[model samples]
Target: MSEVKEMAAKQERQALTGNEAMALAMRQIEPDVVAAYPITPQTEIVQIFSTYVADGLVNTEYVPVESEHSAMSAVVGSAAAGARSMTATSANGLALMWEILYIASGTRLPIVMPVVNRALSGPINIHCDHSDTMGARDSGWIQIFSENAQEAYDNMFQAIRIAEHPDVLLPAMVTTDGFIISHGMEIVNTLDDKTIKDFLGTYKIPRNLLDVDNPITVGPLALQDFYFETKVAQADAMMKAKPVILEIAEEYEKLSGRKYSFFEEYRLDDADVAIVVLGSTAGTAKVVVDNLRKEGIKAGLLKLRVFRPFPYEELKEALKHVDVIGVLDRSDSFASLGGPVFSELRAAMYDMETRPLVTNYVYGLGGRDIDLHMIEQAYRELLEIKETGKVDQYVNYLGVRE
Candidate 1:
């Protein structure tokens, strides 16, 4: 009986949607505060979490703020007050919190936000896209993208540890594709509550605003004299977070038996053509890679899990041997050059000894369906590029009507 109980306590598998997984992770963490506003695709996360708060499953201070901007502001204040704070948002909700996003990161608050990746509004969209989070890539937060419900839950646990690490005191966010991952259900293995609590331990703020004994000033005005140095310090923290992220991932793997890194490589051991992507599209791309492999086409994939601390060196090393690389971006940079991932990847390969020919494929904007056929088309283009050593157009749009 004792042995059976111990085995049962180790792990539990259940079907849960991406939003439910995130909410469950938060419930397990038992954060001190969660201030969030409802947004499409992101509503279920907070809705489910609020029930935990109401039912007293977790002793959390649930702040039902009026707007996303206020929600983030409340989290910043709570975090500054030495509380482990978090929130969830998507699309325009994230846009409303743009100003506070900088404040939280600049103040070095270890706030964890779960972003349900959605297309930002201009024409007003409530669908899955990378525009929302990609627009805020430079906001100094440690950004991690999830490929499925399992990754979404796992990344939330990792995000808490990553943000709170003393060496990497920065805000972090875990993102999943809106409507797709957020609404779709999948089997997820979750650790016991006690195990999660043991792993997370306690919240520690090195220099919180509410530490009356030490009395520190946060977000003080420093015009030309000290602002530059402060910004540089934030930049340094972002750089330091990369190693800390990997270390925490190592620890997490021991507990969950799931391995994670900056990026996931699939069938790339010896490949001539490859595709680099993020979010749920990686899963689609992998299926396409498997099909191409069966057809004797050397194709591979590199799915980026971490975007902010953009794994430049690791990416360069991963793709150096490939003949051609296709970077698929869900959001357009509108720079006329390429999308965000494409621009960064192209720049990363600039100084490589044997750089692979890379091209940009912008796809799946405004919840556009990126089926296997579209992915296969992209791989076909890569094979052509590899053979010809020429790119008819450096920037191309996939699954879009001209």
Candidate 2:
């Protein structure tokens, strides 16, 4: 079984949008089913995929669904039938697929989707925010966030691998920052088709209870007694996915020469203060970390690659040596005590024997520019928390004044 196919073609160079990189990677995987509803940013992903289907580059059924709900439903149906399936959607489209999203994971189908991270509508804006993705965090699917075009392209393959890992027979979502990374063109070094085919391998679904010859029931009418077990099984599978996630990432690094982990530490060693962030802001944070290091301020960064499992233990271990930690949340969980990432990090270190002073900073909401200076400001805030043992209750809206 070739987990990932090797590329024989000349190491070719091409300028492609992040959307195109997604299609190119999927072309390599050669999923049997792709059911998608078109939306801005994400639409280009499906459009390019449709072209791949038309050109005979990939042997698959591309379902042009009428809506995102049908799109997710189509993939679920195909997956239940033992097909390697894929899909893509954004804000409203993702919301439309909510019901089927759970069905996909609960039924234990390894479906993969690309969610162009965007803000949900009320006053109506198509801009980027995790509101769409955050709303579905409770869904059983594994969620992975990509910081740039390269990570987005790389994660497309890894998502399939992680989802289909026999122990993790669940759906997965690869979310790229809306417009900032999705629309912005960057050099994404895509692997050769054969290399990807070997990396992801042909999808082999478990002998599902759905097989007619076996005459077994699947997703049957569960009483309250068994419903608990069914959900517990799902939880167990997600928890077990942590190790498999790291293993797949390591394998990709070996095969593709691109290293990845649940989170990447930039200058964390010997640093007294570190700012943890996710998605595109990590790029800006890196610049800030570099400058701060030169200024003799031992600052560092933790860029989250996997958001669903939350990497709690790993996060604690990652920041074990730091004196102060700053968790930057791009999206606000206003109802919560602080931002989402901050809350999670706090919980991760809550029971630790020795924990660093952690502070939460909420920035870059609704496509706000997360500049390097704001990142520097966050580092300063964390330092103050370390020095005075105090922090602010209100989420700091970077680049904004009351």
Candidate 3:
């Protein structure tokens, strides 16, 4: 017989790496399976989780896969078998798992991955950039970006809920800044075991997939006749997921007192211009907005929290009041006329009869530093775009000396 041995209750405060925070979050949730490979800035997350399994903190299957492709494949298998499974990766590791990422989402498996957003290499650099994840943006999974360690931990908690929601039964990616957030240590207010358990409840194993008495086939090979309908079904699931994401975010706010939206608005209500950004760069933009406000200039930050199922309606409403909007794309979209995120936002607002003047400024490419002054420069560039009506085709590399 198994006994219920309890860990001592202690509300101890300490600084923790984003990877450690993510590990603790997974510990609290007690996933049924964890399938992952060792990837830079993401390896520590699974390493710590492995320790928990050794210590008996979590009774689960820990699959140490040979490669990232196998890791993601393991997750799809576990999730389809009706187990709550998770994985983490970055850069080349994400690139390797490209094929399975789509398979997991298309099959409507609720597996979650913490993508430590990193730059792809031509000459080889393992630093922060959204290039890898941005490359997979078209995959059917829901994507959520975290600005810092705390948000990284918080979003991990929410990812499971959002993914498992019946209407949103798709895989999800919770992204954090590579090396920046994943390696940086900070104070994180993690939920207690009881509180987290109450918040998440039991992982409601889906009846169709997990029923042992009624065995069913999953991932059945579909012919060309049924392929189109499967594609449409996946699209319908993603569209339904948007509201479920919002609803779960609201529920998380009620439980933890931290509210998130499709995009987080920082002092944008009265600002003449606001810079939009995702990931840790948004934190830099926030500080710049504060400093700009002190100088009596109306400036603000619009942080994109949800990148996939791109919150078009919510974003349209959020940017309704601003006069000029500057989008800071961390990842460049070559051949797209401008940066990736900016081009998407520009297209979203292009048809709107009453929309703010949108401009694009690309920054922080190849793991570059995005300081407050750089953000200030971006705001000024947007002002120029508004006044002169000229938007640059290439990105405005932040802090570059040219």
lDDT of each: 0.93, 0.85, 0.84
Worst lDDT 10-window in candidate 2: 1-10
lDDT of 3: 0.84
To one decimal, what is the Cα RMSD in angstroms of model 2 from the true structure? 3.2
Against the hidden reference, what TM-scores do the models get? 0.97, 0.94, 0.93
Where does model 3 exceed 4 Å of error? 1-12, 205-210, 392-394
Residue-level lDDT of model 3, residues 1-402, one tens digit each, is: 212112112333459988888888888888999988998978999999999999999987999999999999998988888788999999899999999999998888888889998888875888888998999998898999999888888898888998888877889999998889999999876667887778777665455566879888888899998978988998998899888877888887766667887888899888888888898888878888888789898887889999998988778778877878988887788767677788888788887887888777767777888777778888877777767765654455666678
All candidates in order of lDDT, best leading: 1, 2, 3
lDDT of 1 by residue, 258-346 (tens): 88999999999799999999999999999999999999999999999999899999999888899999999999988668999999999
Better candidate by TM-score, 1 or 2: 1
Ordered from best to worst TM-score, the candidate numbers read: 1, 2, 3
Using lDDT as the yardstick, the better of models 2 and 3 is 2
Candidate 2: segments with Cα more than 4 A from true spot: 1-10, 208-211
In model 1, the runs with Cα more than 4 Å from the true position are: 1-9
